[model samples]
Target: MNGNDQVSRCGYVAIVGRPNVGKSTLLNRILGQKISITSKKPQTTRHQVLGIHTEGATQAIYVDTPGIHLAQGDRNKAINRYMNDAATSALRDVDLVVFIVDRTKWTEEDELVFQRIEHLKVPVILALNKVDWLDDKAELLPFIQKLAARRDFAEVIPISAIQGDQVSVLEQAVAQRLPESIHYFPDDQVTDRSQRFLAAELVREKIMRSLGNELPYQTTVEIEQFKYQGKTLHIHALILVEREGQKKIIIGEKGERIRQIGRDARVDMQDAFESKVMLNLWVKVKRGWSDDDRALKSLGFDDLG
Candidate 1:
């Protein structure tokens, strides 16, 4: 067959792991956009982020999921259920799944996720990440040996998602397993999330940084409005909190917390749009919002509903 007539390689890849395993970091590195928020806090990603990577004849669609865990209360139950459901939904008729595990250690939590993947009759690649924090290769041998023991994986590749080490090799490994097909996304497309969604996510990320871990799982961002006129991107957003005390912390003294968040979010918006950004932010109180059906719907958290 002629080179031009040959079919391209494309596939769906899901990066599944427990919370804070650097799944979002890997997605951003591959797709080259900040679609998912990264934090030291577990369960940082509460939704499925679709990241598209395209080059030449290879197009890889990567799905990032929140850490799957056992559900407890209404909020944890809701979040964990969404994560597991989203992972299962993304796995439908897909080409492969990348199981990301933190290099520091493996616990019962990690084993539980791997066990779930065992039932799925598809290619699974085990990606052991965060090698940069280690000065000794000897530190990673045990984990490597554990992976080798599992004959279930198609391949076992270790990488530092933050440093972009061996990421391309992982991509190439993914591409090698993909069945030949047409490109699923345009060459220039980076992610499935709209500019509006990304803006809200950026704002939420800022809030995650502004406040401590107390604010992350308790807070969410909604894009109130987004418009463009002349040379500026006009945007308004609301940061939702579950309690009044949380709102106070987010607004800070003399509104300094919100000010810092606004400034940082503005810079990211400008970078995304390549133009000046006019951003308006507000801190709103929504009592037990995570458990409120209306609140969840309003904030785009109703994935199943």
Candidate 2:
């Protein structure tokens, strides 16, 4: 075949791992833009985000999935179930799977992900993430050896998703394995998510990072209205909590807490949208909506699955 006719390589790639394993971070690094919202908190990404990368004729459609973890007690809520379902669903009918894990630590959740991928026929690449945090680089050899014994990975790559280390190598690895086909999306399009969805996610991310440990999981943001007027976007959002007390906590003593959340979210939204944002936020109590399937479906959680 001619060089121009032979360069085409396009396929689906799913990035899966336990919560806080830097799956979203790696996606942002690969695409070189923040389409998926991220926080230090586990389960920060509750939806399936599609990021597309094109180089020459290689077009890789990357699916950034929610971290899969063992669900129990309050963790057995519908939201968590949705996340697990979303992550698992991404694995089906994909040309490649990049299973991400931390540099030096492997938890039970990691094993859970391993079990899920064990039966998949697609090629699985084990990515040892967070190598930048390692104090002794020697530790990685044994870790890679140990993980390699668990499964027959197509390739094992060490990367620092935050530092952008070896990420291009990982991309090359992914691209080389993709089956040749036509580009699934336009070359310039970076992600499958729209600005409106990303705006809501940015708001949720601000709430997650701003509030202390407990509040993040108890909160979810819903975009009530998103409209563009001239050079500015007018956005109205609702911060949903399970109880009146939780709503009070989000609102803070003199509404300062919610104001800060709005401010932070607005700045990020402006950066993402590339325009001024007029954000209107309100705190509302939905009372156990997280555990209710119907409630979660209404809140747009079920669509991820």
Model 1 pairs whose backbones collide: none
After superposition, which runs of candidate 1 have C-alpha atoms over 4 Å from their true positions? 1-6, 73-77
Q: How well is each residue in 1-305 modelled by candidate 2, as lDDT tens digits?
A: 22677668899999999999999999999888889988898999999999999888899999999999999987898888999999999988899999999987989999999999998999999999998898999999988888788788999999999999999999999999999798989989999887878988998998888786656486888888999999889999998988888888788889998899999999988888889999999988888888888988898876653
The digit string of per-residue lDDT tens for model 1 on 96-146 reads 999988885888778777777877888899888998777786878776776
List residue ranges in candidate 2 displaced over 4 A. 1-6
Q: List RMSD in Å for every model shown.
A: 2.1, 1.5
Whole-model alpha-carbon lDDT for candidate 1: 0.81
The best candidate by lDDT is: 2
lDDT of 2: 0.89
The local distance difference test score of each candidate is 0.81, 0.89
The superposed Cα distance between candidate 2 and the true structure at residue 280, in angstroms, equals: 0.7
